[model samples]
Target: MGSGDLNLLKSWNPKLVKNREKVWIKEQELLKENEILKQKQLEITKERELDSLVDPHHKHKNSKKNGLEWMYSDPTHNEDYLLGKKSLDSSVISKNNLKNDSKVDSKIDSEQTKKFDYSNDDPMSKFKIAKKRHIIQTKEKISKPTSPL
Candidate 1:
C-alpha cells in the first residue's frame, strides 16, 4: 500500500484501520499468486501447442512438405532442439575469421573436386572395396604338470 492508502486509512478507527491493512496485504498476496498461476497455465498451453505441431514420426505422401514437418526431419534438429527457446545471442565477431573460413572452405572444395574420379567402369567398381586381412591365432603350448598320487 502506498502513503496515500495509509493516509486514507487514518480517517477510520485505529483498530479497524489495522484490520483493513492486513486484509489489503492478504488480497495483494492472493492477486500476485493468481497472476503466477495464470502465467503457468499460459506456458503449459504453449508447450502443448508446440508438441502438437512438432511430431517426429509424422510423414506425408510427398516427403513431409514445409513448416514443422520439414523441421522435424532436419539433420541439425535431430536432438535437444526446442522450438520455443530464446533467439541466438547477438555477439559480434571479427570479419577476418569469416574471411578465413570462406577461403579454407573453397580450398577444401577444390581439393575434393580434384580427387573425385568421374569414370565408372562398373557400378560396383566405383565403390572402393577394402581387402580383408586374415588374422592367424597362434596356440601357446601348455606343458602338463606330473600328477602326484
Candidate 2:
C-alpha cells in the first residue's frame, strides 16, 4: 500500500525471481558437469588412439557400430578374422599386452609394388636420390657408349 512496498512488487515476479538464484546455481553446476564430460571424452579419444597404434585391428572394434551390427553380422566371429590383422612382427614398441596390442609392420617389398618409396623418411631420401642418380648415369653410359671407359 505504501510507495516502498509498491516499488518492490513492481520489480518482483513470484514465478521467475523466486527461482532465479536457484536457476543460476544450477546453470553453473551444469557447466562444470559438461566440462568434466568433455575432459572424459578427450581422455577416451587419446586412449583409443594409443590402442590403435598398438593394434590397428582393435582400433575399429570399439566403434559405435560394434554394438548390434557386429553381433548379427558374423555369429562365429573370430576376433582376428573379424579385423584381418597379423602381429606386428617388427618397429612398433608394444607397451600394452601383446594379446591386446598387435604389432604393425608395414614393410613395402621392392618387387611387390611400383616404386619402392622409402616411406618419405628424410634420412633415407638422400640415399634414394643417390641411388637414382647412379641408375641414370649407368643408363646414359649404356645409351652413348663411352669408348671402354
Provide the overall lDDT of each model, using Cα atoms, as 2-decimal numbers. Answer: 0.57, 0.62
Off-target runs (Cα >4 Å) in candidate 2 are: 2-18, 60-149
**How does model 1 score by TM-score?**
0.30
lDDT of 1 by residue, 71-130 (tens): 433244212324655444323234445655777788678858866766645656544332
lDDT score for residue 18 of model 1: 75
Candidate of highest TM-score: 2
TM-score of each: 0.30, 0.32
Highest-scoring model, lDDT? 2
Candidate 1 residue 43 Cα shift, in angstroms, is 0.4
lDDT of 1 at 71: 44
- Residue 138 lDDT in candidate 2: 91
